[model samples]
Target: MLPAGLHWIERWLPGFTQRAQDLGAVLSGTATSITAFDGRLQAATHDDRHVLLMASRPFLEARIRERVTALPNVRVVRARAAGLVVREDEVRGVRHADGVVEADFVVDAMGRSSRLAEWLGDAGLEKPRLERLRNPINYATALFERPTPAADLDVAAAIAVYAQGLGATGLSVASLNAIEDDQWLVLVMGYGQERPGRTLAEFRAACSELPGVFAQAASGAPTRDIATYHQGESRRRDFTGLRHFPARLVGVGDSVASFNPAYGQGMSSAALQASCLSAYLTSGPDLSVPAEGFFDLQQVVVDAAWSVSTGGDTERLEAAAGIEPPEEVRRQRQVLRQLLEAGLVDPFVARALNDISYMLRHPAAMADPALLERAAAATSATPH
Candidate 1:
């Protein structure tokens, strides 16, 4: 099930495999008090290298804590940032539960509910205009121990089936995870036109309707009660255009933009943003350079994730209203549709699709002349 032509590429990137392993170790020690839960996981393959065989949030957090705790500059403080303490033209510090913590650089990793906007208001900075597109994505996900070894479960096979739904404008995926026990997280997802049910029984029925692999994976395995999450839309904060910004404060992760979770881009996007911020710090404290660079990098990350999530969103004809995509982005959408459809039968197309999904390749890779030609040829020969 490894997509054709991708194994070699994945061997180098290892896509999420190493990252997931690193994350698991850190989080295990960071959130040691709370019980680790398995709500959802991702399914991906990059160039057939098999990026991540299986991973869970608990594992990822443990990985992060183990690695990050050793860093002298990194502090795992248990408090929420309530506001920014800014003056005249720059940020002096951030206000947390304990009190304002003064720092030369402040990176907000506060997820979506960031207080940066209010803090910016305190500094004479214009709040980045926010545009939201509502798709009303809702789903009930549960974890179950796999009846067989996780090595027996195929991540690419599950994603290939999900890619088929993309052809019809729907989405579904079943992936393996290594928590306390080996397990497979089966998710039956519906987008605008194919959104899932709200109630537990309704969601269970939807799960039953998925490919036999899902039901088979869950069969006889102890299943947790379905937990539901509903995110109404995607929101992007326009930070790059702001001329007046605090010198010391910058936001990261979902604080900058929160995509529809169905695409599973949350953690990956956050990691990229964190890396960008880290990179900016090495250039010294110029403020303007890294601040602008931070937002610019964030926009790039958002654009990449938005392209895939919105392409999936568009299939939901009912949810398409009020969703205004930039007019210049036409080619990416067309290529994505082709990739999904082509991925149904062509392993090469699928490999390319996974690479793009995991942020391992630029969207332009989908437009390679040879790729387009193969996709076109595949579409002509294959019937939907």
Candidate 2:
């Protein structure tokens, strides 16, 4: 989780972060920095004040289940939701194999394969507009026992990105995180035709070709075989713009927007959306009408993540197709490139870039005159 998401979780569920940390979750601090490489030079940044949490998906899920099931008002149910119980365009409950479970509000958390749209359509409600970006990204991840103690690792996380003229050799992106259990979770990603291999030998060879950190992490004894996944596109459903929507029903998490996982924004985005829902409910909203307020708050988080993930994918896709972007886009890319270059040697610029990359700040923060002036000066003074 990023700092923004972690903050909200701590706010709503007090002591959640501390409990996770006590149970061996790795928290970002002065000793844990995230380093980024542009196929050449590298820069590192860390947030000592607001730290992020790192843990395996299963571990996180188990922790959440433990906390939620202990709540007095909450009951854990094991059943499949076959359909929605809609009454006069408002969802009243859910239908399962056994019977129906009623609720005042229904949250669609079925992830990317959610059937909410089809259900809504069957109920004679207007479907939300779906937007998709064809990314065609493939990822392969491997687990390894850390070669050294956690304290001795150079950085907690590192990412090497493919740049146009930086001598990249078919590798799109490579990253490794020092996760819990003294394990290193390393991943390598590629575009449509440049998929990473599934064999252990192929994984090690790819790591060797990447930066030093990747090779070092791969040197450790393998704890698990390579696991692979493919994402065809990044997508979002425009729920706010829909005219005929149901009341007492809302969507969260991947049901709203699922971006490229390479950016590590999925969980954070969902957490922030939950925070938005909390805010909307606390504001005493009208339950008879649509959840426009929640959707509006959620849109801001979705847009920030979409821009960060899709912006890079679109650039790579366009470049591979031998297509040049418009003049305005070219100018914007140029400025961004300058800021990235400046980040290598300037601490302030590096932190700013890190904040933006981690979704702690919006992309518009890059346009601050102070940041632009510093980036310009740093770019001029630094040597490539």
Candidate 3:
């Protein structure tokens, strides 16, 4: 999976510099030309909106493993997941194939395939309400040799292809992430019924269809064949709304909310949820697990991610399902559409959007008094 922007994550998890010492540079306007609102290719950097770090999953995972194990009372275990352990409605621990391990508090960070709902039922607790937005997406990714660094560019190209919900098919990104070694971790994304090719010809065609920089970078050779991942929808189990849910247990990552991969939010959302858990542990009710408080904070994180992702999904839904988005959702889309159109021309809007996308600011903060006024002026000045 791709890594999130560094500023926020670096704040939470220090020592990134030493861990991924060879991490690549950020993709800013200064880095390479980027395709933005209405297919207008332009530079990607601004005052607040700039490139973040570029690192690979293995590099990050290794660092995380090292850091976590170094903790005073932390143990790193490799075990097959069986299910949760619970007494009445409070979760006590986990049950694996070999044996059962107990804990004062438990967390389920399993991804889209999590069986938390089934575990709850097995433990005689009511299952949380599950919500889903169907968006069949398929894509494949592989590592390739990194290109020679471009003149005047920081690292390499990171092209973002935004959909605006107009096309039934939306291109996600051409992320040619320059990583630790002289390798580029490139991912090609597609939506709805479209699928990334499998055969050599198909894969080459898919690569050629991406932005020029990505296509040229991958034109050389691939470390592996095209691999495909499929998911039907974005889902959330509404544990936060349950009054009698289990205590001493929390759901993180996709067990809580699995956003459509097209939005590239799964990891970032989980990190934000991790921060929420840390907040509760550090400051809130110490001994007794503040499960409710954690859920409350976690919900805020999920809501923001869901809004951004579902905003794009709803557009696809309209095309795929022939159902109209709610009036509020439509209005929000219209406002955001205007913002996107004006953002490239307006510096303030660009910074606001970049911060929101990077999770440094709340999505609702898109409506800041000054931002709204500036955006409106920019939109009005445009010849739409």
**Per-model TM values vs. the true structure:** 0.77, 0.95, 0.87
lDDT of 1 by residue, 142-259 (tens): 6666555433334212431344333222444333233435555555555444555345555556555554454555554545665666677888788887766667677777888898
lDDT of candidate 3 over 194-264, digit per residue (tens) = 66565656656766756566667677677666677777888887777676678788888888898877555
Q: Which candidate is the best by TM-score?
A: 2
Candidate 1 error regions (>4 Å): 1-50, 152-157, 160-180, 191-204, 288-290, 318-335
- Residue pairs with clashing backbones, model 3: 29-44, 29-45
Ranking by lDDT: 2, 3, 1
Q: Please give the CA lDDT of all the candidate structures.
A: 0.58, 0.83, 0.68
lDDT of 3 at 130: 90
Residue 332 displacement in candidate 2 (angstroms): 1.4
Error of 2 at 235 (Å): 0.4
Stretches of candidate 2 exceeding 4 Å from the true structure: 44-46, 164-169
